[model samples]
Target: MPFRTSGPAASRASLPSRAAGRLARTTWVDLVVAAAVLVLLYLTLRVGQGTTVRFSTSQSAKVDTDPARLPYDAARSLLRMFVALAASVVFTFVYAYTAARSRRLERILIPALDILQSVPVLGFLTVAVSGFIALFPGSMLGLECASIFAIFTSQAWNMTFGFYYSLTAMPRELDELSRSLRFTRWMRFWKVELPSGAISLVWNGMMSFGGGWFFLVASEAISVNNKDYALPGVGSYAGAAIADGDLGKVGWAILTMAVMVIGVNFLFWRPLTAWAEKFKNEQSEATEVQRSYVLDLLRRSHWPRLLGYVLRPVGRGLGRAARILGTDDRPLTHDPARQRTGDIAFAVVAGGLILWGLAGLAEYLHDTSGLGVFGEPLLLGLATLGRVLLLVAAATVVWVPIGVRIGFSPKLTRIAQPVIQVLASFPANFLFPLAVWFFLRTGLSIDVGGILLMALGAQWYILFNTIAGAMSIPTDLREAMDDLGVHGWQRWRRLILPGIFPSYVTGGITASGGAWNASIVAEVVTFGGTTLTATGLGAYIAQATAGGDFPRLIAGVAVMSLYVVALNRLLWRRLYRLAETRYTL
Candidate 1:
């Protein structure tokens, strides 16, 4: 040894060299992360300035289509989506928890959510705009809130269903344990219910985010009561480009949206998805864990460590505050008589509201064009239903096998998951020009082309859920199959199909709803001065909205809602029950 360094003086002398060595060892990841941070900071500053200047006056104006302003516009759009997603999460927890925990509440809440889910994207925007404007009068913030709420409607319902399903499906043993421990409501939610439901919530949240993107154009480019309102965003950019027949701007907007979607998948979804796997109730024999380099970097980073150290006291103080505010653990006693009376009252009120709504709808339609007008809408509904069923069948046949193959392989899943997710989140309308062009060029029927477009937006639901189901299959079951030499169609029919049936049903329900929603945008495509309208319910609703025919719009939406709810109750619900009884792991 040259010289022993043991004293404080020696340690102090080594610090500079150690720091230099560590800095030298930094990889390209660090540089990339640094660049990203700087870019984000610049964008934030630019967007902040733009917001103040743009919203200074109360007048609503058209969004600019300048390529240079695209970044700021995209930032604003993303901010709205993020805000809406946050609100959806809060709503999902409260709404789903209530529905799951109380039988009395569940009777009312579940059907309410079902009807809400069936409500069209434009319906939400049409109903919400005036209320939101009144709430935040004389400010751009009001329109912003309305836009966010529209996106929220697209996102919230499925997430609520996911959480509620997870909660109700919790293992009996876990429920008994919580009750035996006399856990406080907060404790039960935080420690038991939340964790148990978290994986489902995350998956549904991803799907909801994708659904929001599908409706982004409608939400941002608000057209209600025959008046068009445009916000500065990629959605508005695309809408304006389509209206002007500017293919160049449309191309640019598409590219920008793709980049943003990829960035979001990597930065947020990848890490969250990896983290959520840990919350799954069943253990697998697979040794390899889902990995996220971003998450790993943050966990090991020096800055995060220092920040944690600084905030340690604050965290402790908050913990103390939480304990002080915590509620008692005692279980509440139920009165059967009171519960019965409450149920009866709720039923009466609900029945009255339904009858009143039907009367109003009938009156409005009669005043406008009479009940004879219902013929066209009912025919459109049947056409759309045929397309939905056909597309769903096609998707199931194609994706189920592919999804299972990928899900069963860790290496493949690691590679393909993010790509599939980003693709799913891509707004289907971005391809409208290409689709319209193809149909126009090839002389194909617009009806066929429209159904394909609808399928593109909806099929990912089945794919992703199939993957989730396959991944959840126990290793022991797989091993047992292998040992028994079960293979080919026999193995699939006996094991794999049954295992994924529940997930497939969940996905199918959502996919069917999404297909219906997508019809609004996909059924009618306009590009480069060419317009194509497919004959269906989507076109019907789109026409009504465009013409400000409120009665027709409401009627079309109601018919669509009825179809969706009826299918859920008659078909999917039965399948779900079968899955629970026979296939649940």
Candidate 2:
């Protein structure tokens, strides 16, 4: 048969048959998914209305052991994570873009970001809880909001750094091309800058999620002014179980968390990773695009086709609206006089505020304790710094090689990626009891145990970034090295280490900051009525917070922040500049 031979009658005749074929191809899975979605919507509504379960402040502090309740608890916890992730994304775009684009903003914003990143997750909770509680007095929603914000604090900073770094480090050719095209700031952001930064942003988002989990337990089981305000989630459940010394419940919580983390990676992050590869500026000749079965299934499904058809008009309308929103047409130009005046004014204002804040804090400390009180906290800061350096050094030695090996092999990466993500997401605090037991049994010092705990939380930053860097190495370069008979330590020293150095620096910076934050929890761990205290800034901060000694806590936090900012300025910033100029691939 000659198929359709271009006749109107022939096309009309084919329409019915095409429609019948489509109908015949509809599967049971689609129907099942539709039903499941409906049931989920119903459940969500019920949960929101507090009809199915009450997540009240009073009830949130208790631990429930009924296996059947685990699903609801898990759902509540995951909801907070998703909400916080959404907030983090919004924050990353605004904060990172603003800092990256404007040199004037960068001066203030970059330093502010560093300080914020160094501030402990617990510090955010302490500050946020009281305000949130006052805002929504005696309501569960306020507590939930505060918990989500705490998680946001944990997740936002590193993701912001990733985006800003990516934007600043964009290839010169791409920048020239965008300028040649005469792209407005908005157009350049949409068409060039955002796409260029997408891969790094996605990878960092995954890492941020892991950090969110690390703090979720503490955030959920919060105490403000010695008053417990536990929210109904797996975190609070685990915290209560640990407090009550219920090993069985702890095991169950661990299992549930494991399942949830694995499921999320498969359902969300895996697909995102595969999708973001298309946005890479330079695609290697032999680099295989990462694949996700979930993504493939969605592509092949009829639902996506129908949804796209339905949303096409809406998308076009939005595009029109975007174009109507005015973009800056003038080319960017430097105004030395204006810039200098702005800088001077900003410095004056900022210096005044800082001096005023410091004076207030000093007076407060003097009135309560004495000027000499800062001496102990400053000494503690040094002790914590030593532990951080040791842990970061050990972690880099162990994880970088393993990350490179896994990243260079696609088969290995596919097999190991999800597993590593799951491990990274596992809360380090959940294992505190086991760590304490080991320390007691071996008669190891609490200081060593605390360092190990901090390392467990922070080491993944190095490993994940190393893998990302390694995987990005061009295939042609690898092949060229192979043809030259490059192998073993020689290959690593010349090829891999240099290739991954920039990423290693990025990871190290974040990991160092994270270790500082992890210290607050790690330095003062109490497991099953056994307390282990390490004498450091983290311990000082934790003890002060626990005892409601606001003056001491503020002093400890101030000292810790000073150490972090100083180290970042004197060490990491210089390293980062070197990486930007010399080591970037």
Candidate 3:
């Protein structure tokens, strides 16, 4: 048999002859989902439009952080969130590329990333605020940037991890195709790696957006060492409410959050998901097309038309550039100029960081006490890191097996799916009262309280991803394993485990990041504040808020971000590499 080849035009075409059949099957499936989402959006938007919401007056102090601008604050917070999300995507792209292709680079990068991610949100707040404030002296822009950065801390890790997961878990066939073609790294990345990974990354982005909202109150409102810089945002308002124990305000806030989430899902995420599904290579015959009024309206609008016009030119330019850069199927001589440019960029960043470190050292020498405060947060971050690691590891072990088994059995998956969704949807705040009561009765430590909070927030990522991963395992693999007489432990160890490794990692990393958000609430509690605090990053943040210390809080957030970045670079990167090399089919 002679080798078969497609024409260049055919290769670049968006849809193939086989695609029509797949579309026929899937179009109706997504149409139904789109319709339901539209209905949900209508109800949420109608209910959320009014200024009046059910609230109690007894908790006025808690919700009074920016009493004069409640609605404005909420709007601002939402806008800032979008801004942070944009920044997060850019940052993720940069970091993912740096760590994915190069092993030697990854070794240094991953550990540093781990420390950044592990450090608490407060650690960053403490260090960054003064600097940001200094950058644009006497301007709200600096304050705004600080607040947005806080939101970024919550949102960025999950998105970055999503990209990382997609990059590492690329299908073996795709990897082989790229390798056989001898495609330049950029070509393989732009055409194959990115497109294949996009669905999962988009899904992660949607989830992370919601998760980011949950942390908005904590991130926007700064409290450190007894000094409070209550930025005008939803978070500051919510934090105030928590502090004052206002049930009505809390209820109102929760309602607002729900409405926003529902609206965002319908308007943005739902359509994107539906469209992304259309790109899948296979679809169940039973699947259907989705109908979306918003999308229908938008499809006829001028915006997409304008976007098409703009992007057409850019796409052409990029194509030409790729060719010029030697991204053809056959190998080409490496470009010394491009390599040198990259080296120069790296050198600049290194030099800038060195200067920053030197300046910090000089300042610390002037006031030894300043260095001592930073050390305190470092220790607190470490304690928090330990708590997060223990809980995340424990959750993974418990959830992976259960999720995989449920996934393998359709009936079980169907029965368990709704229950799992509900559990995951339940807010950590809902569990706090019970957690607090249980601890009070037992006179338990804050460390235990913090762990429980972190666990509750983080566990679902592992559970959900594991289920998705396991269910997505190719049917051919299942048959092959059965034919080989693989069963019980052997089947799981050899088949199920490897199949779901990517999902497990996705869950673990997201959960680890969620732990950071959960810590602030976990370590610092106020049920009329008989004022119990833990010896962790969360406690440090809570105490700082109480004491009104902003510098310490920023310091804490910095340490936390550093930890998270370091962890991903170290643990997550290693696991990703293992998956790509060892278990990949």
Q: Candidate 3, which segments miss by more than 4 Å at Cα?
A: 1-76, 102-108, 131-141, 169-187, 224-227, 231-233, 278-310, 321-367, 370-386, 401-438, 441-444, 475-491, 541-574
- List all candidate RMSDs to the true structure: 6.6, 4.9, 8.4
Tens digit per residue, CA lDDT, model 1, 1-585:
597778878976775666566566666666666677799788767665543333422355477899998987889988878878999999999898888777767877887777888788888888788787777666667678788999998889878877777777667688779768966566677789898767667777888888888788899998887778777889988888877878899999988887887788888877887787777555455566678878887655444444555565565565466467654222246677887797899889988988998998799889987887777888899988998989899999999999899767877877887688667877767787888779978999878888888986788888877887776676678878999999999999988999778778778888888888888888888776788999999999998988888878888888998888898889887887787777766
User: Model 2: runs farther than 4 Å from truth?
Assistant: 1-43, 50-60, 302-332
Point out the worst 10-residue segment of candidate 1 by lDDT: 49-58
Alpha carbon lDDT of each predicted model? 0.80, 0.81, 0.65
For model 2, the run of ten residues with the poorest summed lDDT: 51-60
Instruction: Give the total clashing residue pairs for model 2.
Output: 0
Distance from true position, residue 385, model 3, in Å?
4.8
Q: List ranges where model 1 is wrong by over 4 Å.
A: 1-61, 301-342, 367-369
In order of TM-score, best first, we have 2, 1, 3
TM-score between model 2 and native: 0.89
User: Per-candidate TM vs. native?
Assistant: 0.85, 0.89, 0.70
Candidate whose lDDT is highest = 2
